[model samples]
Target: MPVIVLEASDFTSPLFLVRTWEVLSGCITFSLVASLEPPNPLSDLHSTFRIFCMFVWCFFFTLTLLIHILSIIQFHSLIPVSWKNLTMTTAVLGALMGLSASVVFAWMVMDHGGRLTHTVAAAVASCITFLAYSSETYVLRTQAHEQRGYMGSNPGLLKILQLWGGCNMIPLVMEVVHSQGSASGLPSKVLSWQLWVSTALYGVCVLMSLVTVVVILGDLAGRCFLPFDKCLAAFSMIGVLLYMVATVICFTKILQLKELGNRAPTGVTELIIMETVVASITLLAYTVDLAFSIKLLCDRSHA
Candidate 1:
């Protein structure tokens, strides 16, 4: 049995207000989109993308409400996971997903022809929802500093970005895999190998990141016999090296394919270019994480 202990302060807090706005705006955005008629054949992609946006909204809404309810009931300690980490993770993911949804939904709505007024209104609401989620993330960060949660730290946040970047590469990798047999040549083979290697490197990095996150969240960092800080520094360094290789491979191979003109499948060049950009950003994040990890290790040694 769970006891219900409502905290008035929780409801009155700035975080609560932002979350309320998120829920309201999310509802508005989805409702508007849902009310519109099904899109025409040409706009099917846009319609499907809008559905993704709606799913994002619904996801955050449900999670936010659940967190609120949990907090009100004072059940934080009963949960298996760290409440603070969970909150911070949700806030960060919500902000990223909200921003992506807002931009994508707005672009889809504006680029095509139909129900302009309603879609535009929905886009505006989506933007507001993004802002709300961003605000929540900011607030959570400030609070996290005081709470001293792992996910609130610099390295922890970088891990989330790294995960996102790795996930972004998946679509491009899948595209390449799907069109594997469509082309046959030395250039094609080389390009495929490059993409595969890059994907593999990042896949390893993402796996390490997930392991690190679990260690931290499970409160096993201190209990583990391993030299966690040193291992993290080593992992970060290796990740940086791997990302550097991946970045070079991606940019060089992609450029070569572009120059070859028709060696690569249609639209793949563009996807690879986008993936390269994400990889570049992810590489920078890995570098920063390496620095932070080293600093933490040094500080620990001195202490």
Candidate 2:
């Protein structure tokens, strides 16, 4: 068992963490210069903007999750079609997933005093859970495909899974995820066991992140902090980015395969918004984490 500890300073407060996190994570913490706050440490420059962002993030997260169920809906033919059903499904599921990840990351940050062992274990557990979700997402899509002959068969599920979770998960199992390659060759259909480039591209990123996490944790307790946890922060944040990129590539392939073309998918923009929110939330989580790591390294160096 091991645990990562946060050494907090008297002046290093939550307000500082949140602001620094927002800035480093890419939000324009500084609002219009002509605003009325007078550039105070507690300025409310982006007050309205921040609130809007938060609302958008939560909505996107939850909607994505719910939309996961829309896979069961049908939309096509001369009677006029609306994929809104499916899009909404994705929104719902995406939201749920976003929320879960947020809770876990926030909990980790807020309870930084916990032992390194717990943090390490929790991180591993969370990753495993996500992997499981990935598998289920695949299963759901596979099942929806066309409900094959057998009692458990659902071809429709597979078809949609290939659309939703299937694409990204494939990269997880195959390439250095989050890389840029044509998404057309997904799910890594092994043609005589020869690996697909799409698979390899995404798999490498994933493998690298996994190794980074394990290596960093190996010294969790002994290392002074900053660098060790920075490794964790890097691995985790990079992994998030990897997921976003891979998922996009996967979606493109699915769309192409389905001949979705330029017309925007019903909820694609919403899904993107949701993913962006998750990215922001993730940024906050890791910023708090590695920032503390930075503080620790600085303190130790001065000592």
Candidate 3:
């Protein structure tokens, strides 16, 4: 029979406290948002944004609770992943998603006139939840040097940022594609190729980051035939080139739409603009990762 042990110290840890705040604030956010009655009928984009925020809150709440329970029971070892890496990944992802959700929910409420007390409260709670998650990320990051996991390192954290940026680009790109013809008064086919290329680039970024994170967390980097560090550098270089192409495509398309007198619905133009910004930021992150990878390689060669 296997013995089950409880670690009281885990409950007192800063990470645990941060997670507790995340759970509570997340609960408050969703609860308040659920009670809100939109003063006016919401557009598809607005409704989607609201639902996304609620989903983020609910999903993180459940995930944080489960993590806490596993820690309390000291059963995290049963999972094949590095516990530190898992927590760090969760913290980074949760912080990004929470911040995005908070911004979206707050924007939606304000756009709807911001008169409802519950809606405003929900937005505030969402911000608090974002802060909690951010704090958790900071705490985890500060302890990264103490852990052997790759996720505790700078490049590993940047990979999470790249992943988040890629995820953000996908939906925004999709919305841009869906609204292309109607928004710019041009045929969808006119920009179809460009949009599809952007989508493919974003998808590739997400796929690469996800694969890298999985390899690190699963401790499979060493078993790979190719040197993991070199592979990561190659991927980062590819990501940079792809994102550069994506950025140019995005901006050029946006300029063309503007020149054509954009007729995009409330949030469609914003979505396009947001996609461009995310692509640029993701590019910057990839550039930094490439630099870090090079530095690591140089250091190893010197040794």
Best by lDDT: 3
Which regions of candidate 1 fall more than 4 Å away from where they truly are?
Answer: 27-58, 107-122, 175-199, 257-270
Sorted by TM-score (best first), the order is 3, 1, 2
- Residue 136 in candidate 1 has what lDDT? 83
Error of 2 at 61 (Å): 23
Candidate 1, 111-179: lDDT as tens digits: 555456787888898888889888988888776375748788877889778766665565545554444
Point to the candidate with the largest TM-score.
3
Per-prediction tally of clashes: 0, 62, 0
The sequence of per-residue lDDT tens digits that candidate 2 reaches over residues 53-87 is: 24433443343333322221211211222233233
lDDT of 3 by residue, 169-269 (tens): 87667667766656557776767875787678789889999999899788888899999989998999999999988899878877866876644355566
TM-score of each: 0.77, 0.26, 0.87
Clash pairs detected, candidate 1: none
Clashing pairs in 3: none
